[model samples]
Target: MILIVASLCVQILCAIHVIRSSRNQIWLLFIMLFSLLGCFAYLMLEVLPQHWNNRHVRTARAQVVGKVDPERAVRDAQRNLDLAETAANYIALGDAQAIRHRYADAESAYRKALAMGPGGDWGTQVKMAGVLFERGESAEALRLLDAAPELGMGSERDRRALLRARILADLGRAAEARLLFEDVIERIAGEEARCHYVAFLLQQGDRYRARSILEEVERRAKRMDLTQRAAQADMYRWAGEQLAELRKV
Candidate 1:
């Protein structure tokens, strides 16, 4: 009896998900006609794949993989690069190498992408700048970002602004960096950006402003559901640690 009740519940939930998802009429027919197996199949094949593709789920899966083989990402990226030498694949290889702190390898991959692709490759340039910045080549990072074609609106622009700000900060151009950081924060208000800005403020001896910014990030993060928080786990953890350190001060 319990099994029958649970199966019925599954079918109802699957039907609701199908309706919400606008899946094909065939799936609805399958759910209606094939009973328990149909509902289970639909949940396994359809609903779960959608959930798994979510950013948080992908991050969690990557974390699990990272634990097992720290170098797996670099290896997988190389295999993909071997299969397809496209600009996109090279970018992926660069990102994977960057994660492993292989900045020289990452820089080479990004440069290859730029050389292989046509002119005005904004993404490749920006990625190369990131690797340069991480490797403490701040002057090169600034030059790359400045020379790249004007990234059009939205996230691309904000990303370039943030990187430029960081490079400026590293180069002792505090006023310029502060303005750029403020503009980026006003535009996107992303956690990573806020945390970075807070660090900048602290470095500049503005603890009050840093504390306020950190508080805002903490409040926003606390309000997110588990999945949303997990998607931003790295930034969230950074913000949390920064906030804790600030409180201690």
Candidate 2:
């Protein structure tokens, strides 16, 4: 009886050692089931010899090289105009990809441009945010859009605000998005913004306001020539489509 108890105690110690040494759950379970033989087999075959040496190598490498900074790399790319231009082309292609719902490719292209540090280039940044939003990274898109105000003045800011508002609407923050759309309309009076704002109001069930806005946009577009009117007509057509689709739902 004493010998049996001693063997059991030895087996328990070996099992504990095996559990500590390896992360394999199956091995641990086996050791628990047939303690003596299982523990011995695990020690001999599973517990890695020279594990400390491997850990030392990894530690030494980490000491020599620290974490990579993506933003720093982007800054370096920004210093080279040629690279930045190439990144711009990539962003354009990304827009095309996004229209086709090729979200992965769109994301890859946008990230490449972002990595090029398109600093002060709000257009590229907004395009990147659009790709991110389409790819279901709406939170990150919002962050990028929110950073747009710091970039500078121009159409980029307007476009970024519009994109951000659209994302906010998608996330069901309609009230906040409506305020943003209204602000955008006030800052930049354009057929596109009017259309988007009207569509947004329509989505929120403000049909009367939406119709009023659409009528105003139509009246403004009618005073323009073929080229400008065609562009404005496109906005009205898109707005009409949005309204039709919403009603179907």
Candidate 3:
């Protein structure tokens, strides 16, 4: 009788835990139906796995959600902003809005982040410039990029240069844009930069060079690690689409 009572107590405790965790309702039934065994199974199969999921799985899920509902992050960031309107949170919101193609909203968010500070946030400045570029405000984008605080030599500088190249391309400064693009393409360039370079070459009637660059990008994409592929799936997809269009030409 004591053993049965202990089993029932364990089952009840497990049920309460699963409920509080907001886990599946089926877990409650399993615990109630099979007592201790059900509780053990539930803990092993669901609870433990939830606690033990690796970074890759979590990151993959986040990337999937970002693609599936890009606005989800924006909503989350907005909630954080409502809770505490911090500069970082506003930047996060701006990033999410930009990802969702809400350039106006993103610009507003970045401006809010900038206004909260003493001055000189190169990252936020770059982001706002990107939004402006997307909205076809290329001159303003150039101004912002030129005004950005120098962050020394590295990915940050490369990204700022890339933005400048894009603005130049849109402004029909092909010679300058091509030079910057070539400089960026020498290193481990992002897919966007690679694709833009290919597009630039195509515009100049350099089909062979454009095709070679696109082929290299596609080849590299095919060899990316699981985490990298997940993070860059959209860029790769866009590249593939562009490649198909190029091939058809």
TM-score of each: 0.76, 0.55, 0.72
Over 128-192, each residue of candidate 1 has an lDDT whose tens digit, in order, gives: 99999999999999988888887568887898899899999999999999999988998874587
Candidate 2: global Cα-lDDT?
Answer: 0.69
Per-residue lDDT over 1-249 for candidate 3, one digit per residue giving the tens place of the 0 to 100 score: 999999999998898898898888999999998888899999899977875566656777888887788778888999999999999999999999898899999999999999997788877888999999999999999998888777667887887888888899999999999999989877635677888788778888888788888888989877777776776677777778878877988
lDDT of 3 at 241: 86
* Model 3 ranges with Cα > 4 A deviation: 1-59, 225-227, 244-249
lDDT of 2 at 183: 85
The prediction achieving the highest TM-score against the true structure is 1
lDDT of every model, 2 decimals: 0.86, 0.69, 0.86
Q: What stretches of model 1 exceed 4 Å from their correct place? A: 1-50
Give every collision pair in model 1: none
Could you give candidate 2's per-residue lDDT for residues 1-249 as a string of tens digits? 887787688777776775676667787677778767877777667664545346444544433332343233234434453455777666766665665577787778777777886477666667778878887889988887777656466776777778878899888899899989988877775677888787678778888777667766667766765544443455667766755664565
User: Which pairs of residues collide in candidate 2?
Assistant: none
